[model samples]
Target: MFDMENTTVLDRPMLDELVPSRYALKIGEIDVLVISDGVLPLPTTMLAHNAEPAVREAWLNDMYLPKDAFDWALNVMVARSGGRTILIDAGLGLDPDLQLPRAGQLMKRLEAAGVNLGSVTDLVLTHMHMDHIGGLLVDGVKRQLRPDLQIHVSAAEVEFWRSPDFSRTAMPPGFPDALRATANHFMEEYGSHLRTFESSHEVAPGVVVRRTGGHTPGHSVVRLASGGEGLTFAGDAVFAVGFEQPNWHNGFEHDPEEAARVRIDLLRELAESGEMLVATHLPFPSVCRVAAEGEVFRWVPVFWDY
Candidate 1:
């Protein structure tokens, strides 16, 4: 039985003053913070499954979020522990090619949080999507954030993004090739730091990689455990829990069925285990818990009064 109601954790403010959307969670001696790079607006039709027009329209209308547009919050997580700074996903770096407004605010927020990119020793890439890996390189040539940090990505993910299959498909315009090139650049610049993890292996002492393929072929999630606290970094597995009702597929999922399955399983696991989760596309801060009532699942924002 999952608690479908909000917990006492939400009583506190979760975000920092510099970036109102970003939030920080403390686990033992580690500091895990989620920073907002920006947001985007997409069509609701692109997100809905082939369902009744009236029903979907009604749902969107009731929520007040325009059916013609869906707002997606972009976030990147930074982990600091044992004097080593690690960044989970890079946000959309400044790019004339990308239309998203939240592009390239990592360094700004980091500085606001009193963090220097040069101190980062490792980078854990959940997947190589443009929004997630955009900040990996700066101005398309320099490694701006972390010049000396090791960048770890799953081998399967690396292969999939680099494959010609991506470029050959009818992907959203200007998405495939540019993203592929970034992946190649990362591999080249940080080959020594570029390591791969199997399906379920520990990347750091308290951070482990869990496969949750769907958004991308080799997409996965990150689980952080330290002391008595636990949290999962659900990268695009379940965007806004609103449209992704129950165990439904996200509209942009490459393989909708796979995305639905992975999301359902993840919700079930989170509900049963009572662990915390932070999704990239979820609202800023994006931290919540899954609650199961009968067959319907809901996201209960963690009451983190920071």
Candidate 2:
């Protein structure tokens, strides 16, 4: 019963000026800001894995999403606690050659939002994916953009990318080399400040890391608790469509089956607990609550503040 003729697709132009660069929210005493690093236009083919073309069109139509492409916002979180500035992900770096247009603006946006990048004390990486870790470097070098920042990542994730087997395994074109390069760079440049953890660990007071390990070998999520409020920073754990249809895996997932499984479980938990979610690749602001309906879930975006 989907109405194709009534479906309205997103037609907004992709530009940094068109959308607000940052959004702020609070969870307990911790101050959180969702910083924009720019957006990427990805083909719908990258989503809805294993679904028929007709089914894919129907799903997109129902959601009022463009059948041709989707705008994926590269959202990075800045968590301030006890005077310490903690960045969840480094975001895509500012390399014209390496990043696409309108991307790699995290630092600029942060500055505009009154965040002092020099004061960033800790950098917690959800995973070593290019988009997430790209901002770690400066001008394609391995040097830390913030000299005082200590890097934290999952031990398993670090080991996976650094292993010889990872280099041998086939990956999307140029991805293996890119991963190896970044992994080696991090170890060489930030080894002294790098800390690795297994499973769950507390990065700061009321901020915890949970190992998810479906999108990547060491993929994880961060939970922020304050007073009685909670928010989950889900890094590439679920995209927009993936949020509604947890069973439909993205082509970019390291293990599609495992990713789908983890997503379904996490979505159900979030819905039942009523925890707000900050997704990296969802729409602008990228803050939402997962609403469970039968087997599927829906993304209920937080209301805009004027």
Output the number of the lDDT-best candidate: 2
lDDT of candidate 2 over 1-306, digit per residue (tens):
112233223342332254677787789999888888888766786786567878999989987989988767899998977666789998877656544777788766665666666778888889887778877665633333566667888988888777734422224466667766776775776778778899988888888888898888889999999999999998988888886678776766777788889899889989999999998898779888999988889889889754
State residue 181's C-alpha deviation in candidate 2, in Å.
3.1
Model 1: lDDT of residue 48: 57
Q: How many angstroms is residue 113 displaced in model 1 relative to the true structure, after the best TM-score fit?
A: 1.1
How big is the positional error of residue 116 in model 1, measured in Å on the Cα after superposition? Answer: 0.9
Superposed by TM-score, candidate 2 places the C-alpha of residue 176 at a distance from the truth, in angstroms, of 4.0
Candidate 1 lDDT, 65-87, residue by residue in tens: 77767777888887766666778
Q: Give Cα distance to truth, residue 46, candidate 2, Å.
A: 1.3
TM-score of each: 0.84, 0.87
Candidate 1: segments with Cα more than 4 A from true spot: 1-19, 140-148, 164-174, 181-192, 242-247
**Candidate 1 — what's its lDDT?**
0.70
